[model samples]
Target chain A: MPIVTVASPKGGAGKSTASIILATELAHAGAEVTILDCDPNRSISIWADRGTLPPRINVRSDVGESEIVKTLKQQDADGRVVIVDLEGVASRLVSRAISQADLVLTPMRATTLDATIGVRALALIEEEEEALGRAIRHAVVFTMTRAIKSKQHTAIEKSLRGQGVDIITPPLMERAAFSALFEFGGDLRTMPVQGKMEPAAENASAFAQAVYNRLVGKGL
Target chain B: MSDKPTFSIDLDSLKTRRKDTTPESQGRVDAAGEQHGFVNREPNRKRGRQPSPRVGQVHAKVMPNVADEIADEAKRRGVQQGVIIEEAWVLYKNR
Candidate 1:
């Protein structure tokens, strides 16, 4: 049971969306999973209530700093893969969450501003690593980008890589079906979106598999 | 020998006063089998090569109790949580 924490300092960084997609994908893949929605927005929790979640996926909301460690430990101890969706900005909850994260995923769109702010999330992970006296593994994934890699996307990625950041491949493309997921309250697998559904499913699957491999391929 | 690593975390380390909340008066194992405030010290047994500094940065899925055990061992050994994890990871790899 691993704990994956999706974090970014900038808002609308796709933390909630990535959280949903990963938890749902893992559940569909036969892994028992739980998403502890630590975001105040309750995006994942609301989505779970609004739509039929994939089997073996559990979404919980209102998880704050005080209980994050406990919840992470408990859910993980139960053999449930735990995914935590964190709010943007630095806080006690955010720090506490990162301290316990097995993998800290910082999501950002492809843009100069996003790249700049994404550094803050990476810094937060480093700060926690120092505090806990441990290395916190993390990576940056391009979120809400065009399917075709733009020049800007490549430049930003190259810069991050040069700075020694592990960039997870398979960017979550900008798809109407992604928004349709939350709008209609269901997962990308079963969510009905004419024309956009198949590509969106493929994109989500790619991103999910990349993440899962990164988790498994670590320390080998 | 089983390839699976079964590391038992002391329920007592979890019992230790949480960094956030007030220390509890009663010492009881809750339904979750979590014992807060109990500190168990096992001799620091060195295993394999010392982990490189980058071991702290590697990310992967691991058993949940592994993190707890490392956290507890960090406290017991007066080392960083990452150090314990790095050592445990090397041991797991070599196991």
Candidate 2:
């Protein structure tokens, strides 16, 4: 199993939502997914509590600094996929989780504040690579995007690309159904009708496929 | 939406690789994280002696003189009134 950690030091950067969407989408695609809800906020647990969890997905909540590495190692079995949703701070827990991550997905909104704070995770990854003497795969995903790309969004995308940062394409758009995952516990298919359901599913599916490509060594 | 092709995952294609989980490697990771200001942020536990677990109450009614004497003896001995009660129980049991 590949351990995919959704991390960003910036709060409200869509870490939980991205984790839930990715886990459910991957599970829907026939992969047994276990989400380690490492955030103190327990966003993933709350979503799981609100409704019946979709098939093939399990969530472990309240994972802290002490148990992160051990938990990741224990859950990284042969027949499952592990997705870790981390807290929104630069802490040792994030570092320890990144150390075990097969792929690190830093989800940030198209804003300068998010990029400034989110870049710290990337720096920490680079430093860990140097210390551990291994290349830790990492990428950035733009979240809460709109159809009409703002000038700031374009500039940020360009800057990140220029720095050789792997940015996942078809960035997760701002969708009503995506936000409603917290309200309705299950995946998009099982949840009640929110806004348009078709495009939301498409966006999530595409994003998960992009992540799957990265996990399997297929460049996005 | 029903017309969309089903997306299937090949479980066998997803390979899990081993990472260094040794104490030395973890120490190095911690050091690197500290350089980036990602220090341990777990909340500190409360420091100090915990409260005693003997929480039962006796609420026995006695004569004023006897209660005063018991209180004086406990204060002089620097022990709780429950200690006096325990000693009295031992004496009664022996008798």
Q: Which 10 consecutive residues of model 2 chain A have the lowest summed lDDT?
A: A71-80
> Residues A150-182, candidate 1, lDDT per residue (tens digit)?
999999999999999998877888888777768
- lDDT per residue (tens digit) for residues B1-95 in model 1: 12111222222222211222112311111111111111112224598888677644567566899767777889999998777767777999999
Clashes of each: 9, 0
Off by over 4 Å in 1: A218-220, B1-95
**Model 2 — TM-score against the truth?**
0.88
Return the top candidate by DockQ: 2
**Candidate 1 docking classification:** incorrect
Task: Assess each prediction's global lDDT (C-alpha) against the native.
Answer: 0.69, 0.91
TM-score of each: 0.68, 0.88
**Residue A208 in candidate 1, Cα distance off native in Å:** 0.8
- What's model 2's overall lDDT? 0.91
Question: What's the CA error at residue A14 for candidate 2, in Å?
Answer: 0.2
